[model samples]
Target: MATWAQFAAAEPELAVYGRELLREEQGYAFLATVSPGGAPRVHPVVPFVADGTLLVSIAVNSPKTRDLRAEPRYMLHATVGDNDTEFAVRGCAREIFDDTGTKWLRAHRELNVIDIPLETVLFALEIDRVDAAIWDDGPPHRQTWRAPNG
Candidate 1:
């Protein structure tokens, strides 16, 4: 998998749209992680993409957090609304636990959520592939972006 900066550098325009889809207000997306038994477990999540990183903050004590720590491979899919625009990424996730991560988590007031019982932790998904299906007049336009081996 490649870093978000690497993917953005390779495909700026697509990255812009993809990032918006992931960060849009009330946006819907699904995060797929490997279960202990090697099965796929999908969960609804909110994605935040900024400063060349795509991250998702989940409950600190959640099973998903442990799942990602054990196995980083993941698939993230954006919900295609009535517009029929689709976005997805495949990558490996890594937890961000330093002060830098803490600051970011604090800056985003949305993550300061009170209803959640457990604290939240952020995980960055270094993107490997990006796919989009944008609606047009006729057939939907499709595009895929891949990072160059560096």
Candidate 2:
């Protein structure tokens, strides 16, 4: 298996953006998780940052949610700057659906108050490694991490 650091090293534009936006800011992340049958499911997730934890909500019936529930592995990607930079991470997913989970679920009333189950679990990945790959710039840049040292 490729180490998370090695994986990130292959893509630098992603690393640069991750280093920049991951600090006390709010942004969205795209999640990819494997289904029980080995197929991949991708979903756009609105994330919350608190104490360095990136929390994402998933409904029980959603494909991505089912994927994470069956397999606790995931990959996340985010980009900025007219697509000049890309940030990605690979790690394990954890579920949170208790008291605190309710608070997070209710944080956005406009979106979370829908008839869909509000008690959906929270899937969080602690960014095991980050990578960046820059295009349309001078030269491609890169960096790897054993864990998110940000």
Candidate 3:
């Protein structure tokens, strides 16, 4: 298992998908999870990468959210560029609707208009592992790491 710090250092290309990139490519994220019957379900969603965890606020009535709650294990696939320079990670998720989660959701009004229950658990992903690809040799770089709760 690679530590988050090691992943960050090895996958320098991920820097291009930081928060600023979220504003433009946020909608391209694919949230994939397994259904109760062992079927596959994948949907396009906006994701926020904060505190080393990824967040996607779903409506209380969303089928995906329901499926996710039942099965916290999921994979998020995000890509940029024609060469398919993508990043994918599988992690457990839990819903978040608490005041704090709601506040975070509200701060980003552009995300959605759902009232977002205040009891939602923050589907926090510890990022056990990640797979990333870089198609070009533009330059060697590193992404700015956001301190947790900073």
Candidate 4:
């Protein structure tokens, strides 16, 4: 798995486009996690890149948090645009309990103009692979990038 910075360094163009798609809808992205019952659960999450990592803050008591704790593997997909542009990353989430987590919560609260409770937790989405496509006429332009150790 790789940090966002590493991915950007490895695939500059695709990384920029993917970042745009991820932040297009107010940093909205769909995060897919594995439920304890082995079913897939999707949640709308706000993702932000901080300290070279792609991070998302979750409420400590949220089912999403529970799922990540039990099963770190996850997929995060950018919200598709009107033109059907798509971007997604598959990876494992690593829980953060350091100052980075605190900084993320504070920044997130400020950005959204709301209060984020202290019980919130942050997770870094370590990328295994990235996939994207852009559709215009005929077949869509597609690209994929995998981490060196992924």
Clashes of each: 0, 12, 8, 0
lDDT for 126 in candidate 4 is 98
| Candidate 3: clashing pairs of residues | 94-123, 95-121, 96-120, 96-121, 97-118, 97-119, 97-120, 98-118
**By lDDT: ranked, best first:** 4, 1, 2, 3
Q: What lDDT tens digits, residue by residue, belong to model 3 across residues 1-150?
A: 332344455555563443333433445677788899989999876776543445776766677878887888787777454555556666677666556666666654545553455444355444545555555667433223332331
By summed lDDT, the worst window of 10 consecutive residues in model 1 runs over: 109-118
Q: How close is candidate 2 to the true structure, as a TM-score?
A: 0.68
- Model 1 scores a C-alpha lDDT of 0.80
Error of 2 at 68 (Å): 0.4
Q: Candidate 1's residue-wise lDDT over 28-108, tens digit each?
A: 689999988999999888777656778888897777887899999889998775588888999889899888776666666
Instruction: Compare candidates 3 and 4 on lDDT and give the better one.
Output: 4
Better of 2 and 3 by TM-score: 2
Report residue 51 deviation for candidate 4 (angstroms): 1.5
lDDT of candidate 4 over 56-137, digit per residue (tens): 8898899999999999999999999658899999999999988868887787777764456778889999999999999989
How do all models score by TM-score? 0.87, 0.68, 0.67, 0.93
The reply for model 4, stretches above 4 Å from the true place, is 24-27, 113-115
Point out where model 1 deviates above 4 Å.
24-26, 110-118
Regions more than 4 Å wrong, model 3: 1-23, 110-122, 137-150
Sort order, TM-score high to low: 4, 1, 2, 3
In terms of TM-score, which candidate is stronger, 1 or 3?
A: 1
